[model samples]
Target chain A: MRPDFGLLLINLGINNTVYVKTDPREIALLEGLAKDDRQAIETIYKQHYNMVQTLIINNNGSADDARDVFQEAMIVLYEKARSGTFELNCLLKTYIYSVCRRLWLKRLQQQQKFVSDIENVSETVPVEDELEAHGQRNTEFQMMEKAMQHIGEPCRSLLEAFYIQKRNMLDIAGHFGYTNADNAKNQKYKCLMRLKKLFFAAYKNNTP
Target chain B: MEEMQLLDAVERYLNNEMPADEKAFFEQLRKTNPEVDQLVVEHSMFLQQMDRFSDWKQYKATLHDVHSELLETGSIQEKAPRATVVQLWKKYQRVVAVAASIAGITALTISAIAYYFAPKPASEIQLLSRELANIKRTQTITDKKINALTGQASTRFIPPADPKSGGTGFLIDGKGYLVTSAHIVANADSVYIQNTKGDYFKVSTLYVNKQTDIAVLKIVDNRYQPIKNLPYALQKNLADLGEDVFTMGFPRTSTEIVYNKGYLSAKTGYNGDTTTYQLAISANPGNSGGPIFNHSGEVIGILSGKQTTAEGVVFSSRTRNIFTALHEIRKDSTNEDRIKLLLPSSIKGLDRIQQIKKIEDCMFMVIRY
Candidate 1:
């Protein structure tokens, strides 16, 4: 009775328009399953299994593992919902991703005990917090790269030679077809100024 | 000429290609142009950091792409007919349904038997209600206390006021009034409140606001005393347009409290009913009933609701209304008196009473044990 009331209330409350609505199709399927409708559960698994797999694989997990974790996470969600314990706080996608992320992290942590050289895969990446962080990092990195690209060919060459290749002034002078080391160094200073200008401009554009 | 000469020397020095005499000259250049030198150093470090950042970014993107492709292929290979799970679930449907119906009937029968045979205990019921009110007060106070101690202004993935199941609450009073969203404590049989200092105590009383979906609980045991001389009024008036407001709550049920910075977008009455006010602040479930603060760090409102309708659109209750509710509830015992206090004097007549009755019907008491 407790479980039934819980499930019924959640299902009813969820149906209320005030509770940010999920996909009608999915909700219908979920409802049908709650009412013991078998076809609805099958349709949900068929449609969402790939999406779940994609999320897992994107976060440093293998396809096979993604499938296993996705299935298990779905089963856990299903059980929780069936028992009327699952509260629909977020969109179904967000909830599923969270569950999948947790399962994947657990799997990784277990694997880490056996494998020492596994890279520091961020276990928390599947959550919205990590997603936002990852997005910001990507934007900043892209802005920086674009600025570097916009610095013109001469400045680009100068920066790459001086910073990346660690080439001496004389070698850079020869490479850039300059008159002497002093001229090469002056050109490098001008190029650095141009690069800085481009970088700041791009940073400003991207940030605000 | 001086600027040109200085630039030449700086360039040579940075390239490490300057002759000893020129290097000495460059050393003097550093003193005269310290700002420029500092800028150069910082810029160089920035470039180095960006280099590492780019490398990792590319690596991560490539990994993501590979992962997605692999997952796609795996799904294709493992794709089962859509009807399979549904069929299996449907097959077991009748058995579970019948069992559930029997359980429901039995529960109804037991309740009927108890009502007829065992008279209600009056003192115990009064104690239960009082205890519930005390618990709610404690929960609100505990959440506020935790927010103050952590200096975390925003609410996101804060650990719960109760640490065991990872729910978040705010301390509203030194007397252990903890306020959290009802959803956090909905299923809790026993609740515990923990502070940033890691002190925890068992909480027994719980008061829930089902309409607003807010819950307040209080800790009974005094493992820790409330901070002396703290302000406990509702947050300041609802935020103005674009005014930065902060929410403190547990977003992901994590150990650390999450703080989210957002601005008030729009204000309307609850569900657009106009009887109550709602403020748009970025909040999640665990944030329910936690304090919303302005930049001055004063409570501007309490987070009451959030809607994930379109991306980035969230709703919160205005502090003024929540304050009114709390004030009326604290001051009055009878529903009539509470409604009289809550509504304006002009709206306290017979017709008004009927309307108040409707509102009361919509309001359900949330009980958390």
Candidate 2:
């Protein structure tokens, strides 16, 4: 008897996707853009550009302005991905919206316009204040960046390979001469700790 | 199965690495054990964090390369022979002098125009008149009966005998380290905390944000009973537009915590400041410093401010700030944990709620009054 292809496809699809409802393939495509893949970037842009455009338009920006802001946001994402600094802490859509939102808000303020467009917007998360506070701590980001630079070569390389190179666990393991993927992961964790130690040391010294 | 093994299997399953037999076992486990199911969800979040970190590194590398290239090109030109520089300098001198004269003339004309068009400085009497008119307008608007009613209700929330009106805060560590608006608690006779169970404890020794409006308060009594199995919300990075979020705090009435639900309106940048993203949400005066949660009840931001005129334009300090603040308070904490906690919150559908509830259950709760 033949196996049910429909069931197989569903099962395969569910297993590969992070969230059951969202298209996992889209996420993969977005993830691939980290490798400087223009095709993947274009795919992501086509899929979610409307949402980003809407975000800007809703936030008191014109369509033309939205287009410019969206492009700028994409460029920033592209740069971050190329530099290995773009962390996928949120969904691609969310991250894109955030980038656009920040850009649009900045544009409005630079134009010296009252931010009445955002007047009715309701925030569910308290991210705004947090981002502001983080912005104010210029010393912390600078210190953290400096510490990251000072970390030992092996640790830095492992971190860069795993994070910046967008290498899979198995690939990272092979590149780093680890016994297996698990070992590579564990090594990454350890290296992360070392980075944190350096960061703390720098932060502490800078503090009065 | 043991928790570690269970977590590992869940991680494998999330990564699509589970063999048929293990996948079957995991699916079975999910049905029988909600705790294990929750563990899987939490572990998946860690995976998401890893993915994000990886992507961030990739982007950072690209930026670094661009900067290096720019520097190299600039340096090469700077190092060119002196002979070429002298020839170019001579050739450009006449053009440069003409251009400078034209620029100078344009600047003078623009400055003169600006001076001619500029409004005269207002006299003291004029300034006073304007101030009085603004005050009258404010009074007229606030005189509405609804405004009076709301004002009275707000006043009622504050105890007459107690000098300090309650503010917002969060629990750091197992200790009752709470943060709130400095303006709220700057003048207080006493500070107290009320847990989810309605138990109250006194607090003392507070820390304030360096420049912003946040203040931190530590529980005074060493023996004070901290809330057990508290639901500590993970402070994720931030919320995206259309992501569902909920805020819990005392609004006008201090008798009970008010829960308001809304989507992230906008990721805002204040006054051309590109460094931070501000969120517009629905918040009130009493909600300052209250935890803002995603639909899964993960604390994404701290409700800090609301638009002075409007009802929905609430502002928050990002979870990143809290992480940095916590780092400053305790240097021993790992950045991994901080990064994990500060990972941004995103919208997930209702089908994912079961997965999210498990994570929410692990959150530690801090109650303050």
lDDT of 1 by residue, A57-112 (tens): 55556667766676555444544455454345446666666667666665777777
How far residue B298's Cα lies from its native spot in candidate 1, in Å, is: 2.3
Q: Indicate the docking level reached by candidate 1.
A: incorrect
How does each model score on TM-score?
A: 0.28, 0.30
lDDT of 1 by residue, B1-369 (tens): 465565555555765878998778767766798776785575655665455544444434443444455456663444433355575677799988999999999999999998998856997799899999999999999999998967874422223343434446655554555656556577777776555434446665446665655665666764545443333234544456677766565555433455676876665644574323445556665555566655554555556565556555666545565555456457655532221111222222234234233222111112233
Over the stretch A32-145, how does candidate 2's per-residue lDDT look in tens digits?
Answer: 666666556556555556665566554546556755676656655554454454445456675666666766776788999868545323222213543454334435546555
How far in Å is the alpha carbon of B143 misplaced in model 2?
49
Query: Candidate 2, TM-score vs. the true structure?
Result: 0.30
